[model samples]
Target: MRSVGKQLDITIHRPEELSVPLRRAWHEAMDESPDYANPFLAPEFAAGIGRHRGGAQVAVLYEGREPVGFFPYERNSFGVGRAIGLGLSDCQALVHRPGVVWDMQELLRACGLSVLEFDHLVDEQKPFGRFVTGTFASPVVDLKDGAGAYADWLRSTYPGVAKTTLKKERRLGRDVGDVRFVFDERDPRMLHRLMEWKSAQYRRTGRMDRFSRPWIVDLVDHFFQVREEHFTGVLSVLYAGDRPVAAHFGPRSRTVFAAWFTTYDPELRYYSPGLMMHLHMAHAAGGHGVRLMDFGRGDKEYKDWLKTRELRVGEGFATRPHPVAAAHRLWRRPVRGLRNTVLAHPALREPADRLLKSVGTLRTSGRTGLERPAPRTR
Candidate 1:
């Protein structure tokens, strides 16, 4: 390990180079702070991403002989760095022991990064937090209530929809057979079905289907194989008798389950399977030792229904005053700003949504052999 400082020495290593003892220290640091409890911040998650992405590395911070912190990032050849897994990672932070502070500029210099870009940076990261141009609300559910919590919360918070949703579940169960939920489904076939459903949902909603990209597919497959104590790929499935109605694939830490991808069979849309999937997962996750389920940052009806609270997540480039950093910030900020503005206002958002759907329709019009589902019911 090469030292980058006198008092707070920093040593960089490829994700694979992180030893067993260093990993234990990293986990120990995470246990010291609730903000670092996210599975995305774990060494295992970094290792998973590193396996797929060549630039993944970890910078270990040392105070004398003991390790004090861990910083995981992806640095390109041009010295452009991003949070590990960037677009895919929901939580980003340099996990460190409490009261341990370091200069961002010095850290950047040590890692040979002119700027580090992050969208979902944990709020406790004051040094990086200051560089954030905007902060967004990442909704989360407190699972301390567990089991019967979803029904109770729904009845209390959304009385109108509560009866209707519960009624639909009953009707669905009767028509399709007994309803069941698998908190950690191990079926490989179900994984393929989930990808198909999610890809179709993405097209219908005019969102980019990540599965279309081979790297994302490979990365997800790699993550599916992870079974570390700190990071586990959980694929929860909702089934009615023999049919899979909905599925969600995400990584879970001991205390936090980071919601990643969820989609329902369009044929089962009338039953609100996607909503059911989340409610079921939230209820069951508590039994599996999860205290929180992070829904990530975004405005969604489901998030509104399920979130017990919101956490502030920052987005921006943490830099050390370099030309590349300036150029990168200038080039990226406006696009993000405009997108946020459009999403914030319903007047603009409605029109944008309509346009996107129209494009999606045109794009999917000529594609042959896609599964044709029965018409969706209200």
Candidate 2:
């Protein structure tokens, strides 16, 4: 344990080593701060990631032996760290008691990280705000009265949007089968199908397939078994009669439902099944008491059409001096910049997207050929 000031002590522990009392305090702090109440920041999430990810650790901040703050991260051998579940977790912050203050740089040094990178940091993290390179709009649906109220509002506010979506849903039902939705599905088979469809979508779009990583695959598989009061693995699906057409897998807290991994069968793309899935999820989840549906940071037409409002999130590096940190930023920042550029401009984005699809075709086809090989040579 290291003392930051006369009043605070910071101790680092592996994720599994987080004590029960400490876990309770962490949740209490989350409940206290709307910024940190996301289920991704929950101790249960940290524990779940820790079970599969070896580098996972949490820094406990205590004031006179009472836990006051919790910062969870994944550290690599080179002392580079990232927000836990960085890529998938939309909300990132140090859960802390109100009025707790500490030096951010000192905290990084104590954790032995030369640089800490985050893409979806909560805007209230003022101590680290200066380090932000950019901020993005993270759209969300304010489900104040759940989905039913939202539907009524949608009809009144965006009648065209509501009408178009309803029309498409009806067509999907008529063309495929009666459209039915399951908000919190328990079947593991659906989970597998979700992963498979997501992987195919990644390849189809020339994006890196997250499911290709064994750790990620294992993590989702494990999450399927997790059921808790503060956090639960929610697998939602839209079915055409008995056949699944669209599916989403994400974790949810009691009040916040995160819109994480969502994918649908390519065959059903023409009917706009993905949009249908979100609509049903919003209604079902809100009815169950979820006050918000965070759509995460990204620019997508569908999100814009569905969102009630937008929240600010940040992307940047919080670093201490080290050659490794410098090198990492130098190598990584431009890639991020270029992607952001393309995403921001439709003139460039459309061509780039087409180019990526062409490349994806070649890549997947080549891999498929190698995997199948030609018939045995005579």
Candidate 3:
């Protein structure tokens, strides 16, 4: 990509064609940011997606022969191209140098996308012209310095809740066997068990089991083995006596732990093992010098009770450069409108949830094939 004056010259390239300089520039810029700074936006993730799904595109934004930004997205075509695999991620955006700015509309136009959809985009990006929707509350726990300070902060902020949870922990130890917590469990076997538990949870709730997708399952397995400072797989398990009661698996940065998947043994429900695990994770994260625990986008009573603040994320589409792009937008208008209408009514939410549950059940049960075995230990 070439540049003219102050505006960047943006060009769309296949993931394999991304220049080394451009990739380096993107990571360097993203590293300096204090936000989630998720490595999912990095080239490694791009490559992983490319391996799982073809047509992964990397948009290079440049000015005066200098690489400035990178936008990595998958290209989906159903008449027109859309952003690849957007709905499942927590961080989305172009990785750009600090203080560098560009028009998102211009970039999207250049990349030939018909719609640029994002569900977990950071709050700072200004390219999308409209605010599409807001996710439920995302709970975050500060983990600056070490776990001790965070524990003190928790004691001060939610004294009763903290006391109660801690008491439960002690009681669980007395009633059950020894209580043990594993921060970064490396056993792939354990990961498989976590997936099995999560899938079972989804089935019990009549929700879609994401683990059914081979690509997603492979992605999680690949990420679990990946151990980088910025983006590492974190699997925390709480064991009572010799049996595992609760576990959580997700990605973590130096200062942020994104809570992705969580489940607990139903037999130990009285101990509130899930909540106890989070309490332990909070302390562990703080001790590790991390600063935030993102519970992802969802409105749960637990999130509200645990989190001290919230971050806003917006969603919308960016069209491709093709002629059909306009038609795609026009076609999506009604769907967007209906979605907004549903979101506006609290009364309709329960019915919508039920419908989603039904769809999930059908989707999971419809799958017919030999699948991998569940993990023995998690």
What are the lDDT scores of the predictions, listed in order? 0.87, 0.85, 0.70
Quote the positional error of residue 348 for candidate 2 in Å. 2.1
Candidate 2 per-residue lDDT, tens place, 1-378, comes to 897777888999887788788888888998887787678888888888899888999999989978899999999999989999888789888889999988888889889999998998889888897789999999998875554455575576457678887788788889889888898898888888898888877877777778877778888887777787678899999998999999999988888988999999998798888988888888788789998899998888889988999999899989988999999889888988998999889999999989878767876677543122111111
Displacement of residue 152 (Cα, Å) in model 1 is: 7.3
The order of the candidates by lDDT, greatest first, is 1, 2, 3
What candidate 3 gets wrong by more than 4 Å, as runs, is 2-6, 11-21, 77-84, 131-138, 149-154, 320-323, 330-346, 350-378
Q: 102 in model 3: Cα distance from truth in Å? A: 2.1
lDDT of 3: 0.70
Candidate 2 regions with alpha-carbon error over 4 angstroms: 147-158, 367-378
What is the C-alpha lDDT profile of model 3 across 1-378, one tens digit per residue?
534236788777776567677666766776788753765566766766676777788878777677777778876664344444565666677777777787765666566555666666767776554634444334666554444454475576578688877677778889988788888777677788788888776765665567766778887777787776667888888898878889988887666778878899877889888887777777788778777888766666577777867877656665545557667667776686687567667688678878767665555576634233332332
Candidate 3 residue-wise lDDT at 245: 87
Q: Per-residue lDDT of 151-193 in model 1, one digit per residue for the tens?
A: 7865764576789888988899999978888999988778778
